[model samples]
Target: MDPHPPPPPQPPNNPVFPPQTPNGPTIALRPQMRPTSTLRPQTFAGSATLGMCRMKEWWLQVGLLGVPLLAVYLHIPPPQLSPALRSWKSSGSFFTYKDLNIFYRDSSGAVGSSDIVVLLHGFPTSSYDWSKIWEGLTQRFHRVIALDFLGFGFSDKPRPHGYSIFEQATIVEGLLRHLGLRHQRINLLSHDYGDTVAQELLHRYEHNKTGSILINSLCLSNGGIFPETHYPRSIQKLLKDGGLLSPIILRLMNFFFFSGGLGAVFGPYTQPSQAEYWDMWTAVQNNDGNLVMDSILQYINQRKKHRERWVGALMSTSVPLHLIYGPLDPVNPHPEFLQFYKKVLPMSTVSVLDDHISHYPQLEDPTGFLNAYLNFINSF
Candidate 1:
């Protein structure tokens, strides 16, 4: 008796299948019970499928490259600004000069005649943050001037110009000059990238104490002053290439900041949340577009351009300076970062707020931060 089962009869139109080979063909070894798939001859359909797949891959590559250029042109991101931030602005009482808009809260009622305090805001935030202290600030100073520098708050967002920190500094100085505040050395309070703009003002005018020396003293919150010292991984890369990665970051951050929905913009630092504070913060950015100019200037151009000069000035300032910051700031925390500043600025006083505050210490503990700053300046 034959051990093998009988082979099935071939269909009328089917061609004879070729014998399977070890390398040339993949065969299911059940020869006695041949199925159509195992026995069918290879066809051009496989080649066609492969060709289609390759074509799809090629087009995908082209699209990946073209998409960014298109986005750069269109100014639309996969993510956009949240309505919370989009509507956030200083529309109430700001004076616009070209792209810059200055918001002044009258401090006429403050002391007899306190020196003018000009507040420069950080990236993604505007003069609005000052609202927390706006009443108090206006109540304290002879005048408090807060502005949305180019591309922030209610100011114009222009493109492809100098738009650098120094450029903005000139704009800020011009505003002061226009307002006749230059004659009296200006007091400066700054945070985040506002620190860099403040430094730029100091770097240009204060060093020689010559042609345009204006800023009298500084109350600096975290940032830009010490790049190499306080850099975390993300920020290190941002400066590594003059902020080429900034656009991507600006978009991603806007997405996250917006996608966060209701409670996104508010954190513990924004505590004692007043309706006014939330409104101002959400006002700075409505779309990712507003962030581009700030990111490029703050991370790419400003920090890289003045890293050494600012550090030297910070470490050995001709003018009085103070560092009032929180311990848990994401960008400029103390301990490791403070060690570097301490090494350079041994004489510079460093005050740490007890709670975990992000960048804005003044907003974090207004009473503590204000009292400390007032004492430091008065003693000086």
Candidate 2:
């Protein structure tokens, strides 16, 4: 017998069958045939329809949750103005700029000095930024003035309006004319967004533009005057070009987001206090100011577009010029910003504060900022 043997033959109708054992029952094999069922075969059309239905259901669920959340976010009331902010608002008055009401603070400071200093604040913030140095400034200058530019603190935040540096410069001019100071030589102290406004004003003054304010001297601190070296934060970039997302982001903005973002620009040791952050947030919440930020951020683009007019004003003007910089500023960081600033604006005096100081130097290092400004003023 062969070690391996072939299987026993099966009937023609049954191709396979189990072998019978000595005592076990034999299993039967059935003929192969096509099986029938009630279920229909799936088709590409059916798959596509199923997918579409799932997508529709997903969107429906999202909409069901999203709409109410959006409504709640949009309807959330703006914060109540803090007592300090209220006092600040009460102390200041508004002047009409066209149909819009502009908020400003004017103090008749030291009588001995005839120097008049006008303060232009940064973006997303109001003249309240100058509160830290307000008293110190008053002690040195005869007249001190600061304003919340259109769309800023306590100012009319008109929607669907074109907000630009040129318009802001015009507003400053109108404020001066309104106060009967149009003919007097004045000092300009500006920071961040205000720096660009100051530059435009300087351009107007140098070119003898009609109704331009006379400038005695000009000082800028930590502004994106040079777009090349200016680094806007991630949120800023998004808001500037966010389009639809801008509106959503603006509406969702609150104290936590605002404070976190603002606090990042400050140095580790120089961060703002909780109360300070609350005050800043309150000002932004006023008059729905947060909604206008994207419109206001168009200045970043405006800065790049009109760099020549503004930077040239600094380079060619005969008026005294100075820069008070916080080297740690992320927006306009050290080395790059300072190198470019010094190279381009060599004629302008520079005051570089301690390494730890960052943006908002006036608030971060008020004493150093005030001292630097006063020194520049007294230098000439």
Candidate 3:
């Protein structure tokens, strides 16, 4: 008891093992092995099938939600024309060009001067763009005219048709012809997309193409005339090259997107008012004009393809040529564009506005723009 203990007694010789069956090996039914539930073990193939079913269900749910949302967006009605826009439309009249109704405004002003100035507006916008400089122009010239290209402004926007700078130039010529001013010499004031159309018109005039307007002088402002120097915004690039996504984007384009994109080109201090933005949106919305933006944006490509034709027209023309540039324009930024322009067209004159001024110079600085243009016009 004090030092060591006796060894424990041994049991009788009998092994503690499960009884075996006569025909098979003994099976130990441990708690884990005992069939607790009816659920079967999942095989690899079954797991894969379940995953596939879940994926299909997820995609179906997404389709169910996205389809209706897209429908609602596509069916959103165009905004009604604001009173200002309505007045703009009421003042202007439509001229027919091969069954398409083109909107235009012709104002007879300044009895003393016989000179006529025709304005060609940029893309996604219309003649209303010239409204800022309209009265100023009319005061100096005897007549002022501006027109919405076939797919712009209050004009009819036809789908499934190719829209090109060439066609826009033709439309300008047709407008003049409709107004009985085809033979009259016209001073051209163009901007952005209009600049390309002006270039095409200038080409026709220089080549003596029939039905071309007689250009007395051409003044361009903040336009993408040189595709090399021009930089289109990301949205523009996407829309132009979007292909299948274009229609969807066009349908989804609302006032916010339009205004935000358009506002970016303007000088920080010269952004358009909300009402002005609404007017612009209304014009784009009218006649489902938004749908044609991608088609119209193809002009960017056209400019690259026909760079020689357009830029060459500017370089070779005998008519007085001038450029009123907004130095801060992102589309055609300063120094590079200006340097190249002077290099290309040494004979042409240029008027560089303030450093703060960006694209839409006329709207940003109408007085400066008008003075610059008038000075050019007076010099000749």
Candidate 4:
């Protein structure tokens, strides 16, 4: 197969917006200002009436001025893409899927290797999450492919769209076909949300439910594989609840919360620098992504709903399986979920990145993650 195939056709540029519109009149909900001083009664008989009239006029003036400012604030332009994202886009390209644009990176690996590794990233993050390991994999494997799932990263975030793992799997398959890899053997590497997509694909491939894609091996990093044993973030729970307060919760998200939340997922020893944090936040804010946080979070619900099908996929696949875990992962603690993987797949290779490496092993300790991956895939 030719490693440098022609780039896939790009999709038309469009914007991402929240599925459900905000309730009530957007312009009328402006906050009222407090008076600086009490209005003294005038010497005239109608002084009280005059004072009340003055108060009403003052409010009108404030609203007129504030309305324009509010419009500018609400119309926040798309954030500048981070350097990682920009370079990744420059080296890669996009393809159309059901009228949505999906971003993907397909880099040719070292010569003479028949392996094709597909990287699947987790939630609230884009394919950029694989930046640390992409180059390393390309140097060793024959081909490395990664994509931002719809509703995440550079992919089109469409509200009111089906954000199911099964849909996500189909998109992956479509990309594979677009890149001419449908009948080729694939080695799967995924983390967090990507893990679920991998499981569904395996389930389908094992049952001959999918196209010509053949699985050679699989490596799963930290994710909520066993939904029952998982502990999702508080905001995720609120979003999953689908309550009236969901809008407020999403609106309240800012750089501090987003960055701090990312930090918290790391081991105590590993802290992402401000620059790294800002890059991630920039990606999230691109195309007003903050608005669809609640909608994309529906993946948690999908995990719960399809737990059996996904888990069965994990255990029943005939190909070799491996698990690379960070024991201190706050959201998907290793103790709770690792045991399940071990019990189901007793013979699968399991590598524990000890020393409190948290959920993102590739980011926190890239060398260790890469070595483990190389050993696992190369062993067989």
TM-score of each: 0.68, 0.86, 0.86, 0.82
RMSD for all candidates, in order, please: 9.5, 6.5, 5.9, 26.3
Q: Give a tens-digit lDDT track for model 3, residues 15-134.
A: 454545546876554333435343445466688899999999999999999999989978888898888788888989998888999999999999889899999998778899988889
Weakest 10 consecutive residues of candidate 2 by summed lDDT: 33-42
Tell me which residue pairs clash in candidate 1: 85-282, 86-286, 88-282, 88-283, 89-283, 242-300
Tens-digit lDDT track for model 2 on 96-130?
A: 99999999999998987888999999988899999
lDDT of 1 by residue, 115-160 (tens): 7888887765666666556666666678877777667665666554
Candidate 4 residues 186-246, lDDT tens each? 9999999999999999998888984736889889999888887689888688876866777
lDDT of each: 0.62, 0.92, 0.91, 0.83
* Candidate 3 local distance difference test against the native: 0.91
Candidate 4 local distance difference test against the native: 0.83
Question: Cα RMSD for candidate 2?
Answer: 6.5
Total clashes, candidate 4? 0
**Best candidate, lDDT:** 2
Error of model 2, residue 292, in angstroms: 1.2
lDDT for model 1, please: 0.62
Question: Which has the higher TM-score value, candidate number 1 or candidate number 2?
Answer: 2
Lowest lDDT sum, 10 consecutive residues, model 4, at 12-21
Name the 10 consecutive residues with the lowest summed lDDT in model 3.
30-39
